[model samples]
Each structure stands twice: as C-alpha cells, then as structure tokens.
Target: TVIRDEVGLSLDKADKAVLGTAAKVVLTKDATTIVGDGSTQEAVNKRVAQIRNLIE
Candidate 1:
C-alpha cells in the first residue's frame, strides 16, 4: 500500500504493518526525507551502478 501525498503526515494514522522503518524521517510542504539504517547498501550500490550505466 503505497501512500501518496504532498506531505506524508497522513501516515500518522496508517497501520504499522504498511509503514516502513527508517533511522529518521522529516517531512515538509516541499520535501520528504528518509534516512535509512544502511542495511540495503548493496542494493543501493547496485541501483546507483545501474543509473550510471544508463546515463553513460
């Protein structure tokens, strides 16, 4: 269940099961920031490589 909103304050009411965990979260009218716990470093590196390949 992907929740889409300009600001994610609505997540306050969302069920815990559908919500994700992050080291920190900050939301504002213009942006949302999620700081991860770095457990997905390999996946992030792979995606970054894929993006670089695409841009090259």
Candidate 2:
C-alpha cells in the first residue's frame, strides 16, 4: 500500500508539472504583446486567466 501510494503521488506530481508547463507556455504566448519597461500585474493576471481557461 505504501508503494502504491508513493507511485500515485509521483504520477500526480508529474501531471501537475505538465500542466504547469503548459500554463507557462500559454502565458508566454499571450503575454508577449503586453508593453512595459517592467513586468505588469495586469499582464500576469491576464496570463493566469488564459492558462486557467486553457486548462478548463
């Protein structure tokens, strides 16, 4: 049971990593048009929303 649980957790972590990577990709593509000398909070929020939409 312990081994099975560990394997399950590992799989979950891998899945989450993939999803996070995908989210980052989505954010990168969408956030490129944003213009500013520095990173903007609005851009980050927009990117996060876009990523969430992609996941859904």
Candidate 3:
C-alpha cells in the first residue's frame, strides 16, 4: 500500500492477510542506520508514525 512505501518497508509481502493477523511493527533499515540511534525504539516509532500518518 501507499503507506508502506512511504516508510520504505519491503513490499515483498504486501498482501494484508499474509502481513500477519496480529499488530505489525515494521523496522526500516534506513532508520536503524542512523548514528547512535536506539534501533528498537526507532523502529517502533517509525512504524507507529507510518500508521498514524495514514489515519490522520
């Protein structure tokens, strides 16, 4: 979907059903590569921001 692309996640498995039934948190490699960044938090935040942007 358009939202996925914005965050630079892989579209390799875009099918919603295949995406997983539980909550999805996508961690983009680019966000993780930021110097001195907290990888886990950065990933979670990026995913949350992406979803929030869609609804807002």
Please give the CA lDDT of all the candidate structures.
0.68, 0.47, 0.56
Q: Judging by lDDT against the true structure, name the best candidate.
A: 1
Enumerate residue pairs that collide in model 2: none
Candidate 2 C-alpha lDDT tens digits along 2-37:
113534554444554333322222236456332442
Using TM-score, give the best candidate's number: 1
C-alpha displacement of 3 in model 3, angstroms?
Answer: 9.1
Please, what are the lDDT tens digits per residue for candidate 3 over residues 1-56? 24365677667847775343433345696542223323478776886797687879
Q: Candidate 2's error at 9, in angstroms?
A: 31
Tell me how far the alpha carbon of residue 29 in candidate 1 is from the true structure, in angstroms, after superposition: 1.9
TM-score of 2: 0.33
Candidate 3 residue runs with Cα over 4 Å from true position: 1-39
lDDT of 1 by residue, 1-56 (tens): 34546446466667876675778999999977678846488976785687577559
What RMSD does model 3 have? 11.6
